[model samples]
Target: MFAVTFFDGEGWREGVVEADDDGQMLLREVALPADLPRLDGVIVGGFTDHHVHLELVDVDLLADSVLGRVVDLGGNVTVLGDLSARFVSLRSLNDRSLSEERSDETKRPRVARTSTVIEFAGAFLTPPGGYPSDRDWAPSGSFREIASTDDAAAAVAEMADAGATRIKVASNSDAGPVFDDDLLRTIIELAAARDLPVVVHAQGPGEAQRAARLGAAALAHAPFSERLSDEEIAVQAASVRWISTLAIHDDPERATAIDNVRRFHAAGGTVLYGTDMGNGPTPVDLHPGEVAALREAGIDGLALVRALAPADPRDPASVLLFLRGDADPLRARRLTPADLKV
Candidate 1:
């Protein structure tokens, strides 16, 4: 008999379940009510970090940490795909400047790296000279500047043909011009036709509103430019799922993050846990700072756990994550790298 904790959609129940020859027990048996409520350890499904930059952190170290599933929001897909054991989802950015004069390289979106399976976002379609184009850390083939509906549709096709599972667009204009309403709507409609979700990196005043108005499937980062009004929050609540990268905001901009998250949470927006790990000096695992900050923003033990844990959108019965020993949710919230023995 193997000690296992079970997770059904609600919470974890403890029990002992028989293991197979390979030491793996059927997830369904473990989650059964009769099998639960008697186990010595806690078994939960693996945590899924919806947004992370694997290029910035040590993959080995991250595997040992809390994250079990990681989605690379941006970076070289080949590098992220090579890591062992951990499940990885990659999205390649399309910002390479192919010479129009050079026929061979012109139409082909640069496939700088290759991966086993990548949910590639071919390019970040932004207005001319947008957000990431000028950033020092921005990778070479990461930002696509689109000027019209035709350009937008063609860019989407290029990424799809390049094997992109999804599309990424920059609706943010803090650095420069943003995608106008017409172009934004057209991109959303075209992507929908292909059954692909458009991930938008939206920031500041009009960006979040525009993204929501255009029906973006997800927002790459929590809107930090301003506090979203009830009307704006309602719009987002209708569709968008905010990927929380609160730790990316610096000391000066932390207030903006807190305020925005508060409003989003108040309006019942679905918040998915993410860390822009590669953006700066963040820990390899679930950093205590992120947890503390989230708690301050009104997310506590249960809700926090749900956000961090991998969620199966379709099936309720799936692999569960287990945290062994007597770990209080509040104490877990306060855990630092030193406290994690595993």
Candidate 2:
């Protein structure tokens, strides 16, 4: 058994773990034996950056970074589909290594790292001439415009067909036209039918509240344009998850975004770590700036670690362990991709 320290959603605990043949840990609640060989570091499951754009970043770099998985909130379906396929193929190829390749029995296997898992929301489902449609940064086939109820249904259907793990909708009123209440409702319902959660990029006044009222599963960015009322924040905290893209904004908006996330988290809301990478200039790997912003927003230590864990973090054994030698595991900034094995 190897000595380890892991985050159990609420806090970190010292424990002993056993690694399977594939170098994955079998975490359990057991007493640590002093005589057993112990590794000199903390161990954490795989980390995921909840929001990203594959089109803008060199995705290959993420495989070696601290992030084991990334979710592309909006991108060209065809491009993202092909990219996801490529990662799957890489994992398949890597899994075929000979068992005898491990020359040392005492030391744990140093398994070859596989490509980062890419979970994408096929395209930005938006109204005609919506936010990203007018942005030059958005690639072709990245945003699908929905003009009617029929359009919303078809757009959701197309995304589902493309193997989108989630449906991304945009309501950037500052950029251009946004979906009306009826149309937005239609899209949410359609996504629910396909068992896909809907994440919204809600910009402009009241857009964030509208998304929560209409049952969006998450907000791509913390509400930056407006300050939500206590009542509004409370209601949203009960049902919606907010992705922290706080560091991406400039002053004033940056302060407002951090305040919103602070309150939301205080109200028992689920917060996911996301940088909105590729929106402008951001790191392709684990972002220290984003981590700083989250720390300022009252999410730090084990709470911050929980945000970076896999989306479905129920099974601890399924994720990779991050080993940080002689560093404060609570300080996420000190942890990097080099600390991860396999």
lDDT of 1 by residue, 103-128 (tens): 34334222211111223465577778
lDDT of each: 0.61, 0.79
Worst 10 residues of 1 by lDDT: 91-100
Model 2's TM-score against the true structure: 0.87
Tens digit of per-residue lDDT, candidate 2, span 1-342:
666666665666777666456553356657888776655576665678899999998888776676668999999998999999998887766655523346566754455455578899988998778888988898889999888988888888888998899999999998898989988988999999999999999999999999999999999999999989889899999999999999899989999999999999999999999999998889887788898899899998668878886322225323454545543333332222223333
Q: State the local distance difference test value for candidate 1.
A: 0.61
Off by over 4 Å in 1: 2-4, 9-19, 30-37, 76-122, 311-320, 324-342
